[model samples]
Target: MAGGLVAGYVLGKLYLLLANRLRDHTVSIVMQFVATFLVWILGEQLGLSPIITVVVYALTIARVLPLRGEAWLRVQRYAVWDVVILVLNVLAFVLIGLQLRLSLPQLEGPNGRI
Candidate 1:
C-alpha cells in the first residue's frame, strides 16, 4: 500500500511534467487517457494496489495542475469526461440489472425461500 502510494506519486509527477510540456492540444488530451490507463495497469503489474495508485496519481494531477494555473490544460480534461463516465455508468447498471434478472431464480426459490 505504501509502496503503491509512493510509486503513484512519482509516476504522476513525471506524467504531469510530460503533460505540461506538451504544446499540442490533441496529443495532450490523448496523453491524459493513456497516462491513466498505463498508471493503473502498471501499478497492478508491479503488485501494488492499482486503486490506491490511480487515486493518488489522479489527485496529484488534479491538485498540481490548478496550482500551475494552466487554464486550457485543466479545463480540457472535463470537456467530455463527465458525459462519457455517465454514459458508461448507465450502461454498466443496465448490464448489472440484466445479470440480476438472470439470477432471480437462484435468489428466490419456491416463494422467496433462498
Candidate 2:
C-alpha cells in the first residue's frame, strides 16, 4: 500500500508535468494506468489485495493538493460522463460481489453465530 501510494504520487506528478508539456489527455490516462499497474505489482509482492491497494493509491492521487484550473474546467465540462462512469463502475463492483457471494456477513446475536 505504501509503495503504491508513493508510486501513485510520483505518477500523478509525472502526468501533470507531461500534460503541461504535451497538452494531451491520453498521456495522462496512460500514466494513470502505469501507476495502477505499479500498485498492482507492488501489492502482489507485499501479499496485499491488489485491487484495494490500487484503489487507495488512486484515491490518494485524486486528493492531492495543487488543483489545476484547467482540470477543474474540463471536469465541469465532462461532469455527466464522470457520473456515468462512476455509476457503471459501482454497478460492476456490485455485480462482481454478487457473483462471488461476497456480501457482508449477516448480523448475528450475542451467540456469535450467523
Candidate 3:
C-alpha cells in the first residue's frame, strides 16, 4: 500500500508533466489513456492495488489542476469518453450477470452457501 501510494503520486506527476509538454490535444488525450493503463499495470506488477493506483492518479489530476483546451476539442473528448464509459459500464454489468447465471445452478436449494 505504501508503495502503491508513492508510485501513484509519481505516476500522477509524470502524467501532468507529459500533458504539459504535449502540443496536440488528440495526442495528449490518447497519452493520458495510455498512461492510465501503464500506471495500473505497473502498480499490479509491483504488488500494489491497481484500482487504488488508478483512482489516486485520477483524483490527483482532477483535484490538482485542470487542463484547458479548445472548446471543440473539449466537446470531442467528452463525446468520445462518454461512449467509452457507457460501453465499459454495460460490459461490466453484463459480465456480472453472466457470472451469477453460471454459478446459480451450482447453488443448492435454501441456505446453500454461495
TM-score of each: 0.86, 0.44, 0.79
Clashes of 1: 0
Query: What lDDT would each prediction earn against the true structure?
Result: 0.86, 0.61, 0.81
Among all candidates shown, the one with the greatest lDDT: 1
Q: In candidate 3, which residue pairs clash? A: none
Task: Choose the strongest candidate by TM-score.
Answer: 1
Residue 100 shift from truth in candidate 1, angstroms: 1.1
- Which 10 consecutive positions of candidate 3 have the poorest summed lDDT? 62-71
Q: What is the lDDT of residue 15 in candidate 3?
A: 82
- lDDT per residue as tens, model 2, 1-114: 566556555555654554455446555445555656776887788776677666766675556423552665456435644776899999999999896665445555578765
User: How many times do residue backbones clash in model 2?
Assistant: 0
Tens digit per residue, CA lDDT, model 3, 1-114: 777778888889878877767778789678768898999999999899998888888887766535545667667767877988999999999999999999887986677755
RMSD, candidate 1, Å: 2.0
Off by over 4 Å in 2: 1-22, 72-114
Q: Candidate 3, TM-score vs. the true structure?
A: 0.79
Which of candidates 1 and 2 reaches a greater lDDT?
Answer: 1
* Each prediction's RMSD to truth: 2.0, 6.2, 3.0
